[model samples]
Structures are given as structure tokens and as C-alpha cells.
Target: MLKRVERPVLKDIKDACVLMKDAAFPAPFDSRLEFSCSARGFWNIVHTGMLIPEIHQVYVCAQGCLRGVVLTAAEMNAIDRFSNIIIRENNILEGNNEDLIVEGMGEILSKLPYTPKAVLVYTSCIHHFIGCDLNLVYRRLREKYPDIEFTDCYMNPIMRKSGVTPDQLMRKQLYSLLDKQELDKKSVNIIGNNFATDDSSELVKIIRENGFTLREVPRTKTYKEYKDMGKAAINITYNPVAIEGGIYLENKLNQKHLYLPLSYGFDEIEKNLDILCENLGVQKIDFTENKKMATEAIINAKNIIGNTPIAIDYTLTIRPASLAKLLLQHGFNVVSLYVDSFIADEEDDVKWLKENYPDIKVYSTMHVKMRFVDRHSEQKILALGQKAAYFTGSNNFVNVVESGGMYGFDGIVKLCDLMIDAFLNEKDAKKLIQYKGLGCENYDTNCK
Candidate 1:
């Protein structure tokens, strides 16, 4: 007969806090109390920031249970450059190879002269089904090598729910480090340093000029360095995913946090600067020159395009929405917006669109179909990711995927020039037509 034991709810919380306090830094904020009415949501959010970055070297072990290859790809891309060694145990092509895989990984990791900062053991479906006790393995490994940091990435690939994925998992790891540290008054941590289009280094340079020290969580050197995050007066989260970590920091370290929209256009950059000045109690410097250059570039592009209908499909809704807003301001009609459903974290974006431009159409991946594309208007500007670019093709459409870092004033000018050129040239239009299979088979059509 199987024995059933009642689980202690508060015990997990207390134990997590104690363990984290010893292994990491105590969050400056009071984590004992709950913030939201929803206990489950609050705990999940708290659990999100459960790993530290200062632990030197890290070992990534997969138990072969992840559902999305994209999740692993994102994690690998994010951590690959962090001066750490990532070792994958379970092979995607080779199934039921957990023991052999784990053994091989163990051998390789054990061969290292010094202990790793952390060992992040990630599980896919195969290991989850086999009911592998990663905690036990972690404990056993710790016994053999007492100095290494150890943790589990208990991500179920089949779990298609929001707030779960490699992205969230990685964020949790960052949070754990924050919990283990002491606060730094002059220092601030940069969250959301992922493999996405986020250019944090450039932003850090701008912030440093404003007289603040910035520490990127992904670039931490030691556990002591991780603890120093608690001393920061505030945290500036660049992305929505980063917000969760900021919230954790605010709750634990009692640090003030402000969520700045991802810096794309000149306006966004100015707003970011304004917020920094206001919070840091520094004088706001004028970015008027940058703003003027951006505005002029946008205006020039608009004059060339002359009311061309543009369509944008992007991985995240914010980028497309911002692009749509910019294009609309410069006289282009954003007829269609294609976005991934996962990106919509708040309805404020939808509300903003409704208030400013009700005529523009927005389509999520869930509702998009072939009919939508067939009914597109003329002179389309397809701003999309690699995947979205591959699927979309039209005679009136110009794929503007290579605009290169569509952020800041310089990016605006480059994108505007491309759009202007695409709209004015008959040869460019013909090329687009041929690319989309809308022109003659031999590419003989003038398209004018």
C-alpha cells in the first residue's frame, strides 16, 4: 500500500527563504507577506527569481522533457556568451538515453578542476515520465563536490501554460541570485538580458552618463557580486519578462522599480531618460537633436511612401505596435498587424491603439488565416521576424526584415530610407512581385 502524506504549504515558503538566504542574498523587500489577492500567482512570481548568477561556471543538463525546442534555443542563446559551460544531457534525436546522457554529462562535469558556480538540471518529457528525482541527483552530486551551486529547471515541455518556459526559468535563476545578495546603494541591476533584440549594453552606457552604476545580472562574477544587487536604490526593467524579476526584487529587497517600455524610437529613449532623471534626482538632459533627426527621417520616408499601406508581423506585439504608431505618425497606413499571441501581457496596448488609431487592424496568431492575407491592401510593408517573413509574400509587399536594430534615431532613419526606396522604385516593386510569385514566371513583367 502506498503511503499518503499531507504537504505543508508554508513550510515550502519558509524553507525556500531560508535556503535562499544562506545560498543567496536576502531580498531587500519583505517576501514574507503576499502582495496580490491571488496567492498562487504571487508565489509563482516569487518563485520566478530563484537562481543567482555569480556562481562562476554553470552546467545545463536536460532530462529530455521539454516541449518546445524554441525554449531551449532561447536559453542557450541567452547563456552561451556568459563565460559559462552549458552541457546538454538528453539528445533530442536520441530518445530514452537519460542514464547514458546523465552519466556522460557527470563524467565531463566531474573532470573540471574547480567546482561549478551552479548546475542547472533541466528536464524534458522523457525524464518527467521516468520520474527522475533531480533534487536527489543534485544532493548526491553536492556530496561528491561540496562547493558547486546546484538547482533544477523543472520545466515540463507539455505544459503550454503562460508564465512557464525557458525564459521564465532563466528569469527565476536570476532572481535566486538577487535573493542571496546584499544591496548596493549606487548600483542597479539590468534585467531581461536575453538573446532577443534587447541592446542592454548601449542603454547601460546611456545610464552611466546619468551618474548611476549599472550591473547586468547575466554578467555577474561572484555570489558576493550577486548580493550587491540588494543595495541598489531602484531597478529598471527593460522588458515584460524582466518585470517579474523586478517585482521579486521590490518585494524582497524593498527596492523601487520602474518598468520602462522597450527603447525603440526617439520618444521612447527620451521617456527613459526622463524617468531616470526623475527617479535618480538628476537633471534631465535634452535629447532634442536626436529627436529632431528621428522626426526628420520619418517625415522624409513618409513623403516618399505617400500613404502606402503597410503590414507588420512580429514575434512580440510591442515592436509591431510601436512601428505601427511610428508609421501612422509619418503618413503610412498600417492596415494589418500580425503578432504572436504570447506577447500581449496587458490590454493597455490594445486600448492605446483603440484610442489613437481605431482604423488599424490587429491579428493574433490564433485568429490569423489565409483569407486575411488574400484580402491585403496595396503597397504592403511586411515588418516581421524570420519565420513570419518566410510565410508572407505579396506583389505590393516589401519585406523589411533587414532594417537592422530598429531602435533609436539612427534606426528610424535607416528603416525610413528603405521604405522610401521600396515605394519609389518600379524595379524594387517588380522584385517584390517576383519574390512573392505574383509576377510572370520568367520575371519579364515591368510591374509598372
Candidate 2:
């Protein structure tokens, strides 16, 4: 036999990133086997779907698929609102797959202590393989329980290879229960947010003070209130994942749509806020005081942290490129960006980084090569997100994901404060980043 060939595990910092100028949009790295980073900072479909009040989830998948979601509900202490129907091999051979879903749902509902306003019927990849008639399943369920509405959701991991991501699809499906409502011209609902926008943020303050009602899912107390989202005069989406859902509601309900993603850059913040003010027919916000406060906070953090090599990741803020630019402009030594792909909204920011800071490297979060990279290092690196903290071996890191709903000038100030605190403090990075869906309290005993 020929000599056995051995593939060497990658071990270099330079290998982790590309020069910013060479980075590509959507997909920067060539397709190959992927290595998953253990930073489950972003919320999954289960966490998102549960945001709706008085809604139940019934996952019709193999037991293996059910484990992850079941644990999520258990951890949140909401197992009472959750149910499942295990899809066995016999169902694929002799048993009717559609009937399993229709009948299983009926059994689940009849057992519940109280009737849910709606049910999220989730199917797995096995359903797709068997060519299950989902429309038939939904029709039968609707006919059987005319009072209880049904929304179709997915748990298919196979879809990861292509098309709209499960995250995007689940977000769109969240608003499926909303029906036509008499318009509320003074009311606005921020769509597809797992967290409410900060009360102190310019957007919230301006909207509330300007005689406009802002509705957020996290603040909705009842099922009727959640349905009233359809009556909003404006639909605002700041999260990139929620953009599709916002546009969906805009067209279907004839509400004005605004997608102002949380930005650290002052100019972008101003431009977005100005647009919002114009649409809502409110006076323009004065950001002079806000900008001054944010600038002071950044200066204070920079002085404390000095030129410590800073790393940013997409998990914290979807626009890592923009946040990196903000730090660089404020005189921070940003070393690498942990990004899998660039979002469409950050095109200009990407180009700016490419032209001005070519040496600022871009790294793929899921590249197979990342698995072999040395994680333990002596150097003190400051990581801006959980993924960056894990990959950089930085105990000193700001651990916020999805920017922690920090928005506008107040957001920038809050970011600086977090950075300062992170720099001054050291925590066990390994233990901290391992928790899935940060900001939500998880219980080991499930509130027994």
C-alpha cells in the first residue's frame, strides 16, 4: 500500500482571517465540512415561537429532533404549553403520516388544561421525504377544531443546505395568526423582535412622547393584544432576521414598513431615525446630547482598555463590519471579525472596511479549519461577542448577543459601558458562552 497521507490540523492566527479587501459577500469561505462553534447566543425557533402569548407548540418529529426543543421548553419552565408526537419508522411504512399529525394534535388539545389561542404544528425533514400533504393536515385540523387556529412551523435541519433559513421562515410564521383590523393610525408595532427595544432608546422615547403607541411582543399581555398588531399604522423591524416578516406584514396589512437595524455608526443612526420621524409625522430627534453622551462613554472605555487587541463577531451585532468600523474610528485596535457571511444591509460598510482597512482580517465562524486552531493563548484579547470570546480564548469579553436590543445613540453609550465593564472584569469564557439563548433565565430543576 502507498504511504498513508496525513492531513495536518491548522494552527495559526493568520489562517483565521482574510484581509478585509478580499472578503466576499453572503459566502466568504468556500463550501466544505463545517465546524460548529459552541456559542448558542442566538435564539432558536423554539425560543422565538414562544414569544406569542397563549400559543402552544406541537412538534411532530423523530424523538431525536424532539429532544432539543423539549429541553428548551423545560428549561424555560413552560412544558405545560408544549406537546409532541413522535414520528416512528412504522408511520413511514404502513401508518398514515398526515393522519398522525391530525389525530395527534386532537389528542394533545383534548388533554390540555386550557385551550390555547393557536397551535404551532411543526414537522421535521422526515415529513418532506415522505411527501406528506401539509395542506391536507392543516385543513383536517382546522375542520376538527374550528375555534383553535393552526400555524405551520418547521424543524427541518436538511433545509440548511439552501433557501430561506429556518430562522427567517419561523419569524414570518410568527405573525400568521394576525387578521385584518381597523387601522390604528397612532399605533406602531415593532415586528420580529425577541427582545423589546430599550425604553431609553431614541426610537422608543420619540415614538411614545410623540403621541404614538408602540407595541412589542414581549410587552403584549394577552392574546387579543397580540392580534391587534395587525392594526398598527407602521411596522418597524430592526433585526435583520425579522426583515422578511416585517415586509410580509407590510404588504398583507398595508402598514408602512421600516427596517432600521441597530447601528453603532452615528450617521447611519441619524439617517434611520430621521426616516422614522418623517414616516410617523413627528418632530426630528435632537441627537446632539445623545451623541455627546455616547462619545464620552467610548472615550472612557478606550482609555481604560487602551490598545488591547479587540475582536468582533456577527452573533453580537449582525453588522460586525460596522461595529468594527465604529471601534476603529474611535481609536481601538480591532484585530479580527468572526463572521460567516455579510448581511445585505452592511454592503457599504463592508466596502468601506475593504478600502480603508485591508489588513483588518475577516474570519469564518464555521470553517472546518477553525476546529484545529489553538484556542489557549497568553495574550489578553478583548472580544466583543461570545463567539469571538470563545475563538480568541478571551476571558475578557462583552457577552451581549443581538446587541442586547441596544439602539441609537443610547445604544452606543450602553455598548461602551459594557465594553468597559468587560475589560475590567474576567469571567470563565468556556462556561459563559455555552448557554443557549442568552438573556433568558434557564433552570436546572425546571421550577420543580
Tens digits of per-residue lDDT for model 2, 1-448: 7998664557673544688888887667776678898887678888888888888999999998888899878767778989999988899897599989988998999999999999998888998898999999999999999999998999988877688788888988889888877889999998877777899999898889999889988777778888988889899998888888888888888888898887878999999999999999988877899889989988988999999999999988988888888888889999899998888888888888888888987888888788767676798999999999988889999988887778899998898899888889998888988877776646322111
**RMSD, one per candidate, in order:** 16.1, 3.8
Which RMSD does model 1 reach against the true structure?
16.1
Model 1 stretches with alpha carbons more than 4 Å out: 1-105, 111-116, 125-135, 162-166, 195-206, 217-233, 251-255, 263-272, 342-349, 355-359, 366-384, 394-448
* Candidate 2's TM-score: 0.94
- Alpha-carbon lDDT, every model: 0.48, 0.85
What are the per-residue Cα lDDT tens digits for candidate 1 across 101-168? 35654675656555556655544455566655565666666676666655555445355444456555
Question: Candidate 2: how large is its RMSD?
Answer: 3.8
